[model samples]
Target: MSEPPPEPTSIGTWAKRYYYANRAAVEAVLRPHGLGSTQWAVLYELTTSGPTSQRDLGRVLHIERASLSGVVATLVRKGLVEQTPSETDQRQRLVMLTDAGRSVWKKLPDPFAEVRTVALEGVDAGEVATAIRVLERATAQVERHSFG
Candidate 1:
């Protein structure tokens, strides 16, 4: 009889697994704060970068166009974000973190640090650095592949 297909264990598979698992962990901790992972991700991006176009934010957050509306709506309900018309394009909107959003983000650093510390407790900093490098290269590859 032909052997069954070998189980997959490529870098991409492992990376995606880690991505989902990591987000699950974040969601578990963040949900109590009235935020989901995607919402936090949106806030994080806006906090790190400045106010940006909804399309650009969606692209960076990996949120599909159809779903981003709901995400923004939730944050708006929470009074954590604001959407204003883009200066250049009336058709486009820019999303900015409100004072409330910044407040939540500021508070998040401590819990997030604790989570990181727990998750990486056994892994050395060197390993973390290497893993980051690997992930960055993988991200660049994916971005190039997608855009090209």
Candidate 2:
């Protein structure tokens, strides 16, 4: 008989799996609306924060500048967002949601909220809180080490 596959034992492995699974779930929810998770995140930030420099947006979303450029370009092509040179800093681009983008955002349900509801259907509130705390600590440690 074949041996059973080994289970994931490392916290990092589980964290990665959780990230991918959550992303996939969000993508599935956004796919019908012709949006990806990253695109949705950009839109959400713009909607909430109004116009912001591309540099700031990237930092807020923890997305690399190069990847954000492509996402912004795609949003521009879709007529959902517009980017303009900053009046104070001509080298910086300010990105904001167009009227069409606002309309779309107003109509689309919150993908993360929807997915979280399903993903945590039966989990206890305390357990969820503990899990969140543990993960947040782990993420902070990893990021600290990574950037040092």
Candidate 3:
């Protein structure tokens, strides 16, 4: 009988490397702007999605509530973000981008686009689409199996 093909590499391994490499790039670019990658993502999300509950933001970003607490605290202290009680729920904390946050987001698209272009350069669109599909499906499966 023919042997089965060797097992493929796990996506988790590649994802770790991808995160590390991109984090490096983000640090180089954002250092002058006085921001970290997490801070940038928070600011960008608030800019695009308007205000959001801190819990909701953590869920959307797939971050732990404990980790996001520190991230949000840093942003708030930097004056890049402000937290208020949700109008609809007094117990929930809402975070909104400050003017400085908006300014940072507005200025980022160009440099971010540059990085994205480099990342996507020579990558087949079809392959990229398939990879995204596979990753999302894997994530959904994990969540369903683990949480539900």
Candidate 4:
């Protein structure tokens, strides 16, 4: 008989589980406002970062070009985002939130706080800090080697 496969590592399994769980919660919160997690992320970035180049946004968000294009198109159609040719580079597009977008962003409930509270219910502050540090290092390492 074939040998059984090795057990999955806790870190990878938990990371993926956490992502899906968090995504579901975020989706539930955003759906009523006609937004998906990806779309909300784009809007949130524009809100905090001011006008940003489309290429840069994709890079920062780790979004594929095709997916980003579709999301931007949908946001544009909804009148929540405006895209203009970059002043410095005509080939590049700059994306920013419209007044409507800002209004919606203002009205949307803070999604992360509730999720964080629930997820960290019994977790201590030091544990949280350690988790954050580990995740940050992992993120930096991933970014360093990432092609997208």
Candidate 5:
């Protein structure tokens, strides 16, 4: 008999798998509002962070500039976002959610809550807290090393 295939090594791989799985469920919830995960993320960032430079928004979302440009364009066309040239730096664009976008955001159901509840169905609260702490620490370490 052939030997069993080796297991995947990186934690990042599992994290990505989890993200995609949860994203699919979230996408289903967002569909009625005519939004995808990327679009929703952009809107969420704008709502939470207030008006921000496009470059800064991309950095916050960990999205590539090119990909974010396309998403921003789509949101602009849909009347969900408005992009204006920055007063301080005319070359930079500041993106903000329109009133309609805010209204839609308010009306939409929480996309992650139900999926997260299902994911944590049997997990203990303490264990979840520990996992979150560990992940946050790891993310901070990565960012520190990455920038330095």
Candidate 6:
């Protein structure tokens, strides 16, 4: 008789488990600051890159413009970021971190760093790099299949 399916050890299963676990870890760290992971990413980008156009920020963050607009609006309401018309391109809005944002950035813990440190405690750098490449390839394949 034909054998049944193997145990659930697929890459997708592992990737999803890790995704949820990592997200949970991140949320736990940022919950006290009232920031979601996407918000944290936007703040981090502004802090490191200075003011950036909304279009450019969306591209850099790999987020949709509509989604980024909501995130930026939320930050503006929180007084964490400011949106100003670009001098060279009045049609474009540039997003920059406010003084409060800098303060919060300084105070916030690095969630990714914390999770990575603990998760890779026993794993070697080469293994980590290989895994990253594999995931990247898989992601690209999925993206191409869906959009291409």
**Which prediction has the highest TM-score against the true structure?**
2
Name the TM-score of candidate 1.
0.74
Per-residue lDDT tens digits of candidate 6, residues 80-99? 99999999999999999999
TM-score of each: 0.74, 0.89, 0.75, 0.84, 0.80, 0.86
Candidate 5 lDDT, tens digit per residue, 66-116?
Answer: 999999999999999999999999999999999988988898777889789
lDDT of each residue in 1-148, candidate 1, tens digit only? 9986545787777777776777777778887787887887888889989898999999987889879989998998999999999999999989999998898889874446657777789898998999899989988888889563
Cα error of candidate 4 at position 97, Å: 1.0
Scored by lDDT, model 5 comes in at 0.90
- Cα lDDT tens digits, model 2, 1-148, are 9986557887667878888999999999999999999999999999999999999999999999999999999999999999999999999999999999999999998999999999899999999999899999988887789563
Clashing pairs in 1: none
Winning candidate number (lDDT): 2
Model 3 / residue 91 / CA error / Å: 1.7
Q: After superposition, how far is residue 80 of candidate 3 from its true place, in Å?
A: 1.2
Model 5 stretches with alpha carbons more than 4 Å out:
1-14, 134-148
In candidate 5, position 59 carries an lDDT of 98
Tens-digit per-residue lDDT, 1-148, candidate 3 = 9986544576887867777887687677788878777777888789879999999999998889999999999998988899999999999999998897777678774346656778889999999999899989988898889564
Q: Which stretches of candidate 2 lie over 4 Å from their true place?
A: 1-7, 145-148
Decreasing TM-score order of the candidates? 2, 6, 4, 5, 3, 1
Off by over 4 Å in 4: 1-9, 136-148
* Per-residue lDDT of model 4, residues 1-148, tens digit only: 9986545766656788898998899888888989888898899899999999999999999999999999999999999999999999999999999999999899886666767788899999999999889988987898899585
